[model samples]
Target: MHEKHKSHQVSGAHKWLKRSVAHKMFDRVPVVPDNFTIGETNDFLKTHIHEFETINYIYITDDTKKLKGILSVKDLFRKNPDVPVLLQAHQDLVVIYPETEQREAASLALRHNIKAVPVVDHEGKFLGAVTGDQILEILNREFREDVLRKAGIRRSHMMMDNILEIPLWTGIVHRLPWLLVGLGGGIVAAGLIARFEEILATNLILAAFIPLIVYIADAVGTQLEAFVIRDFSISRKLNFGKYFLKQFILVGTIGLILGGLIATVTNVLYPDSRIAFIIGIAVLGAVLSSLLTGLLIPFLFRNLRLDPANASGPIATILQDILSILIYFAIASRLLS
Candidate 1:
């Protein structure tokens, strides 16, 4: 049943939360109480320590199996084996409910450097532990999907066997929406490009490098948005100034070098010095505009209570395309006319 849902291809962060098998697994995770105690923390260590290779700490709970506290193995070593129970050595336990957001739960575990933390129900009963390893696995899977998505690859066909082997009709259903969005955005960009036809006609040479200029800006913006969103997902504060300048300088430098190369190539090919110069300037402007767009749109979306990554995808690309077309034309008009 869950496999069917997992077969659906979802774009952005929605894929992990809405279409992932892990999300389904998490939904059914168990819950336990707080008072659940360890009869012998030592005995649990000796018995189950070999069972789970990554077991870092042992939890002690009550008669009802409600988690009272947790004790690290280091605490066990310091105390005498004859001690009735090691419950006193427990520090303040970190517990999360079953419905806790997966990202939040993972972030807390990473922030605290905990090996695993006990999960609990509303009544504070012991559930299971969310291991750091589990979080690591989730991160790895998500990262792969993110990288693939940036390359414009379809994700549904990649992860789940059920998705990859589905009938052509069912498979097309999953792919159609993303293509529709991309197509709609492309048509809008085409209209913007058409609006700039006068400028292109005045300097026909500029048309040669439109793809290069637009792509450079769009790529830079996408990269910046993804970097910021990923860092934001971690503990780092969103440093606007630092992020802006960092992307500005990096994209600016690369764009300058690339523009110089494009200008040189065009000068050799087209035999028009002024057209080449205009193309170079337009390229540089478009690159900067793109970098700024990449940085601002995500932050803007975040302020508007939206997922920044959503702004990082096809919609942002289309907007960037329109902006790049405008910038390129405006630069060409000024420089050539």
Candidate 2:
């Protein structure tokens, strides 16, 4: 198999890779905001612990630069340093950016053996801090969410039932744009049906199978889109060759199997072998196109820095339905003519 073709396959680790590492990994950058600061080591320690609650370190910063000083409970209350401990007293302060990858951040933290690192902006001003515990928690939560997403399961139940607890309104807030896009997709599908009015009028069976064909294609597209979005989101680097090959193989196999089954079933049930074969071929072609659409559409949206899932979901399925109809009719015309 061509290396590029491996990405589309449903076998082995490909699906798992798409589901696990790609879907659920930490991506959000820790930020303390420009206004973040610890006034003085001792005073800040007293107040910050009360605010953030058992915080690891007090970040010392000013309007321009992050002064290198951090005071933990142990440093402040336990064996205090023999010198005066001020905001800029300590010479070492580790800082990270908001856009740093989670894995890389974790690795850095581990290397230094530090519990917490302050986050700073480009100008060296402290934004906030990320603790070792927080990083691990975020990664674990993301892992669960990713697994659930791949299974077509809601994540609310997995970690804390937040998915279950959050009202549908929350999802609606995110899904509203996609839902509108779905409406537009419906319009496009309707247009395709209208264009094929003559064919549907002559063969009612064609109309009967159209919905099923479109729905299956849409489902496949949704699954592929989810996987691709997760991959792009977690790892800014596009592992294009691998994903492409996997999707192609998996989608192609599904198309072949479905097409063959439809052809066989229709030939057995209906009186006309001619219509059955044509419909089978058309359905198969539509399905394959749908899968490809699902894979590519989200990838493109992500490339453009858009929310791939929200932007691609309704549009991909709608376009797939339109394409399916067109392909189905084109094949039908050639065979029936």
Candidate 3:
């Protein structure tokens, strides 16, 4: 009788609250009162264990249903059954409110190294437990959602299992919006490339290296975007400037190494031409440009109250492509022409 699964089906208006810990919680979790002797509790579970969703941890409450402490099932078995359940329970508890967001609940569960997070009401009354199974589901859903958002797939409803089943128009509506942005960016890139026609004509070899520049820049930017999205998801409140600085130093060092290799390779291939030195500097500039674009775009998106994921794949990659072109030709114009 104590395992009364509360069915607070918050429909329509507050349907979004389905993401809260309350919605995922199992109210049929085994809960005992403060005064139950271990022997009595053992006896009760022996007959009624099938009623509860999980016996991972048994919650204890006072007469008024205020949560007091919790006892692990292992401790329950270790203690003398004649002792009061409260005496065997750990009084120092980690509790979260029913209204806590799913991410926060996951965070709390992780921080405390607990498999289940107990939910309480305003007055600290024991409500229910969001068990390990539910927590796993929450984490899996959030990870997939983050991946889709970062890939600029705007359709949040489509699941991996049914990816092929989504109608053609629905698929395009979600995916094409971001690709259209990329298309506009490509037009701007074409215009930028055309603007440097004089440099390209003077040093035809520079045109040959265009794909190399764009590919390297896009690669660097995609790597940085991975780091940004990871930090944004895990630790939003932590200072981003610190993270970006470490990334800057790391990227700058690698850019120098890669630049040296590009110079060495170019000099080996075209020993007499100033084009070798020119391409090296251009590649270095492209790397740094990519790093800045990757870092700033996500930060800007977050500040604008948008999902940081929207700043990564299409937008960052397109900007890097354009910057790589401008950087490559600007260097060629100065040194090769």
Q: How accurate is candidate 3 locally (lDDT)?
A: 0.80
Which number leads on TM-score? 3
Task: Report the number of the highest-lDDT candidate.
Answer: 3
Model 2, range 127-180, lDDT digits (tens) per residue?
455665666765576566554443433334444445576889775553365457
Assess every candidate by TM-score: 0.64, 0.54, 0.81
Worst 10 residues of 3 by lDDT: 7-16
- Candidate 1, superposed: residue stretches over 4 Å from native: 1-44, 47-54, 59-100, 107-114, 117-128, 144-167, 196-199, 264-273
State the lDDT at 104 in candidate 1. 56
- For candidate 1, write residues 73-174 as lDDT tens digits: 666667766654434546577777666555656667777777665666778765456666667766676676666455444666445437666888876765
Off by over 4 Å in 3: 1-3, 6-18, 34-41, 62-68, 80-95, 107-113, 121-125, 156-167, 272-276
Could you give candidate 3's per-residue lDDT for residues 1-337 as a string of tens digits?
A: 4744545322221543666777787777778889999988888777778778888998899999999999888778888989999998988988877777787788678879998988887899987888998889888987888777666676464367465888888777777877888899999999998998887777677788889889987888888887776677566585877877888898888788888898889889877448778777888899988766788888888789776777776777788898999888888777754
Q: Write the candidate numbers in order of decreasing TM-score.
A: 3, 1, 2
Instruction: Tell me which of candidates 1 and 2 scores higher on TM-score.
Output: 1
